[model samples]
Target chain A: MNIDAVVDFNHWRDQARLLLQQGIHPTAVNWSGQQQTQLAFDSPPATAESSRAYAAGQVPKNFIKLARAAACYRDESRWALLYSLLWRLTHGESHLLHLVTDPEVKRLRHMAQAVRRDAHKMHAFVRFKKQQINDREWYVSWFEPSHLIVPDTADFFVKRFNTMNWSILTPDACAHWDQNRLQITPGVDQPNALIQGQMSDDMDKYWLQYYRHIFNPARLKTQAMQSEMPKKYWDNLPEAALINDLANGSGQRTQTMLDQAPNDPDRLRLKSKKLRQQQDAIRSKQYPSNSAPDQWMN
Target chain B: MQLMDKLAVLADAAKYDASCASSGTTRRDSAGGQGIGSAGGTGICHSYTPDGRCVSLLKVLFTNFCIYECSYCVNRASSQVRKARFSVAEVVKLTLDFYRRNYIEGLFLSSGIIQDEDHTMEQLTLVAKELRLKHGFKGYIHLKTIPDASPELLKEAGRYADRLSINIELPTQQSLKMLAPEKSIQGITTTMSRLQAGIDEAKSQRKNRQTISNRRSQATFNFAPAGQSSQMIIGADDSTDGTILQTSDRLYSQYRMRRVYYSAFSPIPDASSALPIQAPPLVREHRLYQADWLLRFYGFSTQEIVPTVGPEAGMLDLHIDPKLAWAIRHRDWFPINVNRAPLELLLRIPGIGARTAHKITRVRRHRRLRLADLQAMRVPLPKCRPFIETLDHTPAASLLEQDNLRRHFIPPVQQELDLFQAPPTPLVTAP
Candidate 1:
């Protein structure tokens, strides 16, 4: 294995040829002969009659083809180096000095950026249920991720809920804690069960009721809803079973809600005004618990 | 009749107008009494497309009825199309319903001139006010300003709407008189001026960075926080590409519009004897869009693009995109060194998009670039090669021969089936 060494171009070319001979596809090696050779070497200029030249018999010597061969290898460090070199070569500079100073490593580092971003969004948005375990307390939550992020993301939950026992389970990974540091594991499908030490049915019931109450029937766009909370996550949420019934009977429920209207206009007005303020505060960029750092320097 | 029928009639009538974008402005909900949403002071809007078409709005007209006869409009009073008007309450209910369903992010309400400008503007404001004060909606709202509405009423409309827009109606003031005789350019410009004043005042106060309560008194006249946009009808009037671009330049310079929409004229029913029998080819609309893009994103100027010399000059080529056409016409600008060309020069080349330009700038920071390097950057090397010079490439000057380049741009004659192919030979001969 090449491990972490930054292989030079000549060594890469020789190493790649050996690996290819030993039954590895050129794509599988860090210094694949294809891209390494192209950036390490040079493409002959197309003839002055290049416009008339077609590709049927032309042996392809383009840098793009070479870059793709390098990308086919999964080693990110090699890919970053290759990309940096490829970029420099394309911009009219034919020197290797450009690759040495390129900051293109950020792209390699951020390959998992989307996964991390979405995982944080899930953590912020997910509402957990309370269950009593032998008269103590525990919270249960479920999530569906577009990619595997649970292994790294579970630390956030562990840090936040260190004093309370909790579990966050996803399709691919899970995190469990006993009021201490978190233990993460590859996920297997497991049904929610009452814990022996600290699970309560009353807390679960209260949370479920709150969920039902807050759901707005007025703004029920299924397509928009799906884009935010994908259908794949439906089975894991406690409110999932209630969704169909709520949607189908939305009009009736809304009518019922309207009928139970508060009579004291001033009191109702004050409460609603307060609620709107609170909602605005939560959505504001300055909320103390917001995941992202403050956008404005102030 | 049925809601579906109402939607079809209204949406189809509205489709001729291309000002459906729901961007700019981020307002939080402020209405009291247990409402689901609110339009914040700032306008955070949602457009329609996944490619970032914002939609924080319920963009529909309050009515399609009109008193004045604008020839380009489907809802002009003279047209025989069925018309419908939504009551203030009904419009509110529809908005609330759509908002709850989350099909829309907010409301963009416009209307045909009914009764008079004051009455229509008042009604439109009521929808925004009701959605704000009554329903307590906090989503983004954009309202179309009435050209002759009372300043007080227009002010109210602005207070509630996240953004405001006024259609310039057509490209040229002369075209406006010819196509829409009832409307006056002076009236439209006056309202735009007033709205601009309001926007400028609010912006100045906001820049002071005072609290909302402190700013509220200073914000006595709330214009569109998201700013304003306008639309121009293409092909309806005999405005040339040069004239249209010049007007867009003036609007951007004068009114500070956030965006300008170009709505291609669709064919009229039982078309007027004065109107052309066939609409301008769709390609004309596409070319106008390309030209507009060039003006906005590319560094091309109105005069620079239209030309001062040569035959068939001063008119955009209907066959090729404006940038490509410009590149083909001005071959002297070729062989720009991609490694060292300024961002402005790079933007002039076809197939080297803004993103690719940025990519090129970023990638070239560390190394010298070559012909093969561009292909890796995904720059359209085939199109760009003729214009750019890299370490590995230097094309012959014959690459710019007018005939050769023109052949590549304008497809084979079999492809250009014009809209009026069946018109009498004599009609084609007309100027």
Candidate 2:
């Protein structure tokens, strides 16, 4: 097996191109992300001949973009898949990329789709908490992404949240951004670098409140919810804790709502104001003005 | 009330409005800006509620206090639903906080009219203004504009909000008048026209700008780049499916509305006796969305969709999709050759979506298509095979002429989703 000992997509592509130039079949190559180069004899063949050989084989611009994205996927199989497609494009099946119905192409498309979903999910579900690190406020989040997409997706976050200093830690990789530039590094097994608590102040409490109320009890489709934001993601979400309580108590609430007089004039907004004020007063008494981390209202 | 308590009350009040889209805005980011947000392009749903609805935007009412006695609304003056209001600063802080947490896309700041329409509109606008200016937040903001709100405030709102919507509430003017006496059909339409004008003006300014140093003149304001949408409450009034689609078609054509959200009348606590006691079936709401899509994409006019005459008049065929029903009625147009059929003809086939039709057009250039080629594309073969002709596919000679053809496709009442079942294999093998 012609194993290329590198994690980078560019390196893999370079090796694959050389292999294609040398007329190496896909079945003879075993592409890997493992960082162990074989001896000089077994290393990737001379690249000088590949440039001339690759020029004869025309790869579609669409496939280049698609393969670039698919390459960043943590799956080792993507390299071989891309190389095989590359070999086929040059040798025989010039129009093979357009045949999306082909099983191999379909599998490649699904992998690319999964990577896209991973990047988009990273954009959506990374819950950043503010912390005073070395007296400078920084946002840190712990994300467990399904694929190796941090390098490709970090630009989106940098553009969106450039003003704030933040770090996103995942199992496969980590990304940190200051005001100036982004620094990506190899990831650790656990998120020991991130603070789990100490910054989830009153705003988080309000978030939970919003989460509890925003849900409609009458139309419960737990499967639909799970399908979109799967179980693995639920753990990191601050609002995830309320899903069960909200779900379990929804039926009882609906029954009570149904049992009550629908037409009854229950102007509780003003009436409940006094009771809420009393609770607020009690809260103030329990916690004096001098509080660490300050109130989240600011 | 405490901020959390107020948020709970306001969000609960706002849950009935079902428009949760946070997309189709002018793309911008906080890059080189003094803030922490970005918008435009596709909207991301950070969370999904158990009801299968996306929580893309932080949808909440600014206040639940209303002067109007709209019987359908829980927050109407006549209703006893608990009311709470957010101070502008509170809303801004909450929005920024939630956005930072990545729990929301942006804010959908709507309000119940407190003193007047202008006053409510101003309050909603201020929250968006502060989020943009004070925080430099480039995130999406959707404002709900009231009908009677002054054009000045609307212009101001359009400047700050990515999208603005005023719920039409009901399909017909007569039903609207009966249910919501405070709202006028003319006022709503006028607001829509103003919004349309603003959107068009901005678009043209951007398009036809005399580029001075690569930027447009300051006179051209970026006014609601995502444009305006409206919502219609189904089952609250006696309006039929025909009346609804007609209104929708008008809204789409006239106002250039981005979307007309169809909210199934949800049951609220302390419900008004004036309204229908029971909410419409969720299936009906689903059917309407499917039909709406057929109108927008499938080139089906309202008249053709809900037959102008018949026993099944003014109603969509609930058993099958509206597209399938239309295709069945117009069977003479069937057996269009898939290898050479144009997009419009291919679209008329029930199973072929826009994507498949486009794919078919592209794929046929390489080689002639067969039943297996279509199947590999996951075209719903059961619904499509009779109508389409591929190189190796032929329907039974009498299948189109048979009276039981439609019945054969329809599932027994037990299986609601059986009609959508994918074929197993080799129903029609390729030559």
Candidate 3:
């Protein structure tokens, strides 16, 4: 018995439900993507009586949530694993998912965690470039996520950037927002030519300047930086180009700062006094603290 | 100066502050507003600099022109660094631009005393006000509160900003007086106390409104919904880790601070003869953070982590983490049964974290846990082996009593000779 290609969690859940209703064991059904020998036996048709007996609500809510996340994982074995867990939960092992030490449960948990982490990284690393399209502004970005998470993360981008026209292009799928609705299309191999050409904008220059100066040469932790912002994502990041130069020259910069001589204390005292006197004159105006509007009072 | 140059100078001046968190704010998004931003998820680190500091927010000072000469500050009035100030409109534009590009979480605007504390505080608050009220921006905003600013200004700043912070600058009042002559501990704490009162009042009012409405409406008043946090500069004066942790502990309990950042004093370009020329080791700051976590989350007291009457008094162990150090000192508490121990005892184990400890307790309900089970859960066995007892494995009676137990956990010294030799060839390389 072979199932059709699993497109997403919904597809997988529908197929798994049919398999469960037909009383087919998880091992007996071969998901289409897996490279396994075909089973010789044909699966019996699912019946209404079995379906009524194993209604969707009978499974714990936690299993559904975990299954949804685990199904997003890129591994081919996920469908079988999820089905096994679901089958056990309905077959008198209702407490199966709660056992963290169980090997199958642990495997599912790890896969779900990986999917979540991939989505989080997508949120953090996506860089949008501004472009002019037909006298209107559009923000475009090119990202390569590790899993089928483009659809899952579309709502986040839409909610945050609803006022702007933007598109996130990825190899698996692409998400676009047009102020009124979100549209997802098939994946692209390359970003639009306009986005590629306009990657380096005036804002990127200022961003690079901010990044260079904000770094503290006195405390260099290259390993820590690499762990969080790995080298794989550096090619797309404008600020990452300066990382090696800044890290390499940090030692010399710190030494130069140390080599500078201290200013004269007597002159410093006089200068400080002069500044204080100047500030006192300005303070004489006594600006009212409540001068600003209190719109938040309501 | 150009906006680019000012950004370089002001950002350099502001890098000394260690707090870049943008989480724990009220959940909001620009769904129906005229802006394009959101907040209130786990804080996102858009980038990390080589110093390992997260660039979660566009952290910059509004101005570097100062009227007070703090000995440790780069922007002190007496320092020879270039001075620059951003107009309120300029800051608003910069914040919006950066946020739209997804380059930052939001703005963390601090300033030096341009004319006086009140003027500087007002300028800082106006940036947040412009962002929230004019643009309807829902992104995170953190404002640095001037200690001597009036209460009304503080209240206004809290209303617009998600988080507010005032640097304690030093551990004790004496040190603050000696170094930052114009700033006082009383002024800082008094402002913190006022912020705390506002936060509490708004919280209770929100509770009452929720009860009255019997619904979780988004219209409740928010006053620094992320609450107040503060920073203390370590090694600025001669204050020890003991004194520093004690100050943080006090701030946590007394003022209800959400966090207390410990920044190691780094070298400034214009040397201040009154302060040290060299910066402390970065590891010292890391150890202090670990010890701080034990205080807040691990149910450990300040005295237990750093005792008062010892040769190593007032100092954290520079080599090993504070948790392992405490575990070695209190050997009698070891051999805690993994399956039967309470959450608190499980948390005390060297290798088990809060999440892992909770997982252990939950797993043990169905079946007794063994050493292999812990390994399967990804707990570091070597670190907690002698301290924890499992169903299948237990440490010998003499293992916990060994005098050399501390050395076992300390990472072995790196051998420079190995680097000169050729690396060992892999027996089987992956295809």
Candidate 4:
């Protein structure tokens, strides 16, 4: 039997429940996410007269959670994998999920892990560009995710940035948050003109400076950097442009630091004391330590 | 100085510190506040620098103007580096801007001694105070505590910050005195003890309030909810791996430190004639970290990792990881059956980790584990082939009895020299 394409976990869950209630075997049902077929099935239609053999609560809570995440995986085999695990769990093998060596259960876990990792990468790599729209602030970001996780990871952005207005655009879907509510709409191929024009604003420049200086040339480990922040995501990252130049010049920089002569201790101490006195004079005029209020003290 | 230039200089000054973790804090978000931030149990690495270190937080010193003459520090009074200081308001703005853009987890604001210990500590706390109380920001905040700062300032720092740290700088008091003349081991430990007590008292009070009220309220006062961590310079003085691990073991057990970062002494802009001319091998730092994890999580002692009597005494084997090294030395404990071993024994295997051991125990309950089962779990077969025994496969007796087993795990000679060239023995050995 064939059903319509499943859009999300809820859509897949509803149809899977009907298939399970009808007592249809997982292999007998074809789980397709593309074109819908006509009402033609080797098995009969799901009937209300059939007793509810497996209700929602009867299924393990862990199975439901894992299945929900696994359903978001981009593979076409995910639907069949989830149903196979669900079928085995209800059918005598209630301890199937515990056997991590089982192929069907292993695939399910791998899919769920991939989905979770994709969501985490989205959280880490999404770069928001600030824009002024109609005299109000809006943060716009463009991301290319590997799975259908735009809606699943929306709550994290909302709870964190609830006071600001922001939108995360992706190839498959987009998430937007105004101060009041969150809205998920269809995907966009490109960012709007305002966001594109402000890509190289003062924020990006400051971030570049921070990235360049924070690196220690004495300990260059490009392999470690590439393992975490892979080259696939480098095009969107502004700081990644400086990585090759910095890495290529690290050897000379370290040598320069090593070959330099040690400064005279007495001369350095005198210079530091003079600089401190000048800084203190300027700071006291601006901050007046005694006159400043201690309102921050509890 | 311009803000851009100050950022470059201050960030460069702060690069020597190795702690960038922003995890293990009280989970919070800006749902109903006038801010835009959130921090959860897990920290996010927004970027990685070329040095292979994570940029989890915007790590910077408030000012690189010090009064102490530490021989190893880049911002020491006798060093000739550019100086820059950020106003409290400037730090607040940078944190908010970076956090809003999702460029960082939060601020890691440390500073050199500007006026005195108390004055510097107060300035650091003020940044956290404005972020929490004024803006209602819930992001992570880590402040480097001054050892001689007043208790009141330390208490205030705990109330506003998520994590607090004070660098031990060296392993022993004699080395600390020789290098950093102004600091002492006793003063640093006293501050750490006070901070630990505050963290403990606030935690207990929170638990009591939750029990009495029968609810988890948002109003409970938190004192450095993420706990305290510290860093030690590895190659700065004549300290052995055994001594360093012993110090860390005490810190973890006594002071309850969350982490102890081991930073290899890197080359600074201005050379210090008193210190070594060359930096320690980076793999030494990596091996120390690996051995540190064994102490905290694997239930291993400092002596077991670096024994007193051996050819390679008091130093980690740079060619192999610490775990496999331990396994190679104690070969009598090998060939353990995977299907019957407990979690502790399973963890002792060279290739199995904490998570993999737990999975093995759980999976064995349903059925007998076979050689194929380990492969399905993504265990590295070549690493564990001789150490573990399954239902279908048993390692040959001669394999465990071979004297050249260590050579099997070591990489090729050229790659070893390229990646982990051992420094001169006199420079690394403790005199």
Candidate 5:
């Protein structure tokens, strides 16, 4: 069996099933994709054109789930690897998927891990900008994910921000939800068309302001932040614009705070005896000294 | 005062809380509701602050106006810091605005005492109620429960909140009294116990309701699905790491708390005389978190993690991580065969994390693991090399027992990279 390109997990699953049905071995297959080359199949392409259901009684539910995720990986060998795993599963090693230490199994799990992380990061880093699509308001985000995870991560956005209409555009694929159902589109080499949704958002200022002040100068750990947020995401993130400003000013701001003289209690004493009296009354009632502290503090 | 001004003051006051978790909640979304938002799955870190903390929630205090003066708190009544309060409506609006802009996953609302426990708890719970019942905001709501709040109020807060917490403030009752005199240790424990009961009851009730053929609304029974978490301030008093771990163990064993955050006693504006002048070492906080991870995931006892024979005796080793430090102190347990070791033994090996150890155990079912397998899994080879026996690699007896072994594991001081000047790379994984 031969195939030109496997676009997504579903595409890979469909073709792999066809090959398995015909009893074609992994060694007898050549799987290639992610390029726009002309299609060439030795006998016939591994397509579902004339294919019926393969009678392999349900592949392990766990393997299917793992392979589906692993297929999101960009590694060109991912299809072949998954096909090999599937072949091994039905052919001989029944519990092959459970053997996590097997080099082949380990590789599949690694690919799945990468895909899962990609999907999670896609959810975290995607920045939405409010745009007027048609006559209604829509939230649009332009994200550059490492793998083909736009489809895998779409449902998360649907469950999360489902009350609003939104779309996520990426180089690999695109996902849009209009309250009713989700619509997915094929990959585009360039996102120039998608970028037209909205250039800027006004609420970005409040977000940026929060970002600036929320950072504590006393603790400067850019590596820790970068490890999670990463530098690649700094561009699209509205709050990321202040990463440098916050980082560079941290040392100085911390020094200034440290340099300032401790507040003089005498000044409070000088703020009129009435102010002190009021404080005393509140303090006595608040503390209730030499007694059990109140169980609840409001 | 303007809402923005109040937000600045209250948010600054609330930053001391180390938790901003929005995960582990009863999943809900606004698909059929009137307003916009949703909460489910593992929480997302919408942003990261330079303090190296995930800005997962819109963490803010409902008010910084306090009558009880907890010495460690910036919003203490005796402190000179400015005070501000937010109406329930204002908090709801701010949360929605931030959620709309993709700035946060949810809201974490804590407050200082105002008027009385009932009034304060009412204000806090009202914000959550309005977000859930009125706006139909399904985003995560974490309410910092007051120890003195009525049980009914606490239960109601649980209804609208995904998580609730009562900050213990300090490890020992003595320290809590010395530092936060107005906070009762007895009251705090009672609240924790009550919260535990409420959370447990909700789970059973939800389960039973499901069996009775109720719709998915049984799943959304307005109970706090994320359960309870607590925070403790370190270095504010004389409690050592051992004492701290004991307290944490008790909390876990007694109430089945989800998370315990250890906040270093960092300096705040208008410092208190009762506390230390400088903040505890950052490494101290780092070690506590590491030890905490060992306690939670790696199945290591707190005693094993804080084994003596280091600077700050009975404290965790600052130079290396708690796992590596434990491996070094208990060298007699080294040289487990990675190909044949049990999952527990594999986890104890210095370089092998839970993920790697689990992988080694699983894959070895079909084939014996080798050094190459570890390499493919991205295990830190040097750290594990001296402790584990893989098919292709094994440490010499001398290497494992050498006097300079600890020095070998210590990572060099990292040179600071100016991320601002560097070109942005392709993609970074959100941890």
Candidate 6:
């Protein structure tokens, strides 16, 4: 880049600093000034000493200096710094301009990707199961998020279900809702192990049956289907356990599941076998005996 | 077909119109419904922005094939554009696919008047029916009601749709007739009236059901639970701001519309002889929106907003916003005591939005707020300064010199001749 053609980089840097000091991001700064500055000289490392001092709880001489320096750069880099700073403050970890990891790090990396997807699922799925607990009713939902979304997702749950007493239990963290006063705590590795009694069983069976009933055979696009409801979550979802059997020998299983008797007629018992029969009946009614339509992708 | 490609074209086409709102509804998932979703009263529904606007749904026309040729519509029948019609099953499939992918929450389905309005409307209604009844889709669905469609089809449309909209085409009856010769202002208003009547009937039915059936009303006869809203194309016809507001005022008063969307008319793909080659200033649409908000929320009347007549007199000033224009014109009203001003007067202050005005009112109850408290609340003090008198601050009484203060607000900054000239030194610097 020709230095002569370049406008004053330092001037833009100063302007950016002024903007940041005033709590403004210089997103709409003149493009000419931006093009002029060489990255090495123009993009100053703000005041490292002041940042260090401020982080250590010492009053720095220039409180606004760092913000100003942050503003001086083009918009993208400024946002990058802001996010990096926020990440560092929250996680107490910083590795700017570098990437290094050991063999064991790959597991965590994979886990992180899974967690990201699960966070999205937590946002997407995790249907609340309404139940009566001791006269005061509440909605209980169990979501096995891949990662730690409890901190973020709790706020959403609180805002959305403010009127109801709800709890979103996950493997890593369990969120409690008492009339919208929400609190999250790190919990046991698996929530399924902790869930009490026949309620979970009945709920799981009901969900599976509902899923089976709604699954349109004609709309099943394999790649698209898997993309939305990944194979990874199949284990946790009870509906997936019956996928192959239902797909291949749906009618037979329907009869066999129906023939099984009710162990406890007096009580609200886990009628998984009966529910599976109902699912089959729904399937037979919707698609009939000829062959499964096999197209339901939604 | 790749859903993304279809979405790109459809969503892009839908973006030109501003009528996809999913609020002001009271629809929810039914028992044994495969999915659980809700549409509540808050108009805070989602929207997408390919250009930074919110994307609420996969808004698209069922087909851009129409019988009536609206001069300003890109999808007008005479325009030579590639047209596609999604089958009932196809539309249902597409909505489910898009929704499942988490690309959108629902569908905002519109169509050009194919064959006839009744024929097109029935097809559109069928798509909603499948989404709700056959598929048990609990996602939000907004169906555009054709103005000439039967009251029966319109009623069925409301049963499934979270929201329904009827485009008024243009502001004034004269403009609508001149531009869209086929479109009847009476037809548009009649549809709106039918929708409102249906809504009232549903509300009564719901009330009656509460007394009759202790159980939740599964009446399924609910009329546009999200409520009916209409859209007007700004700058398309020779409609003045006064005319536009008067029309909107009537729509709100008569049909009880939830909203009156202002769509700035973009030139048709194939321009008609009557249509302008150039697009209207998008800012005019924005101004209309602001004006509409003032009417609905800030308690401004049509007469107050566009009181003057003449070619330029009756319109909103382009440079300054509508509210700011009002404040500048009505200087006698301001220098209002922030500590003591009523909610109505406080709302009239430029840059002090409804939220801030409410905040000021609330904070004043506990402890009177000084200028600092208002500043902390994020109220734009620069504009507010001319209007409000706090404990620590007051506008110079001389600010009532209308022209002088108006100039200050707009700021007499000299536009650069080219790029080289230096800005003149400031005459006076306010501390």
Residue B190 shift from truth in candidate 2, angstroms? 0.3
Candidate 3's iRMSD: 6.5
Candidate 4 lDDT score at position A269: 49
The TM-score each candidate achieves on chain A is 0.46, 0.79, 0.84, 0.84, 0.80, 0.43
Q: What DockQ number belongs to candidate 5? A: 0.35
Docking class of 4: acceptable
TM-score, one value per model: 0.59, 0.88, 0.92, 0.93, 0.87, 0.59
Q: List, for all models, the DockQ compared with the true complex.
A: 0.03, 0.26, 0.39, 0.39, 0.35, 0.02
Best by lDDT: 4
Most TM-score-accurate candidate: 4
Off by over 4 Å in 1: A1-298, B1-5, B27-57, B210-221, B268-273, B308-311, B401-403, B410-431
lDDT of 2 by residue, B290-353 (tens): 8898889888888877765655667766567778777777888887899888988888898899
Candidate chain B TM-scores, in order: 0.86, 0.93, 0.94, 0.95, 0.92, 0.90
Segments in model 3 whose C-alpha atoms lie over 4 Å from true places: A33-41, A45-52, A192-199, A264-266, A276-298, B215-219, B414-431
Over the stretch B100-216, how does candidate 4's per-residue lDDT look in tens digits?
A: 899999999999987778999999999999998888888999999987788899999999999999987888867876777677666777788888999999999988997899876
Clash pairs, candidate 5, are: A100-B362, A100-B363, A101-B362, A101-B363, A102-B363, A296-B148
Q: How displaced is residue B15 in candidate 2, in Å?
A: 0.7
Higher-ranked by DockQ: 1 or 6: 1
Off by over 4 Å in 6: A1-298, B1-13, B27-33, B41-47, B211-214, B307-311, B411-431
lDDT of 4 at A142: 86
Candidates 4 and 5 compared by DockQ, better number: 4
Q: Docking quality tier of candidate 1?
A: incorrect
Determine which window of 10 residues in candidate 2 chain B has minimal summed lDDT: B422-431
Q: Tell me how many residue pairs clash in candidate 2.
A: 0
Residue-level lDDT tens digits of model 6 in B1-431: 34434443444345456665655566454233244344453333221121223345666777775555567775654555456666688678767654433335578888877656789899999999988877667668898898668888888898888778888877765676567756756667667777888888888888888897788845446777778888888766766777788788878887788888887765433445456544556667778889989998999997777647433466776556789878877878978898899999988999989977886776676566777777666688887887888888878877777555655665445222213443222101111
What are the per-residue Cα lDDT tens digits for candidate 5 across B1-431? 87667877887888889998888876666665357777777889988888899999989899988766577788776678888889889998889878976778889999988777888999999999998878888788999998678899998998988899998778877786667756766768778888888999989988888897757663444567898999989877877787788778777877788999999877677776666666777877888888888888999987788764444455666567889877877889988999887898888988788988887777787777788778777887877888888788788999878876777765443212323333122111011
User: Model 4, range A1-298, lDDT digits (tens) per residue?
Assistant: 7866778888888888878878777776778745566544555554434434778777889899889999889988788788878878887788888899888888888889989888888888988889887898888888888899999999999888889899998889999998888899998887655345555446988999999999999999999999989898886777898999999999999999999997654455465667556434433332223321232111
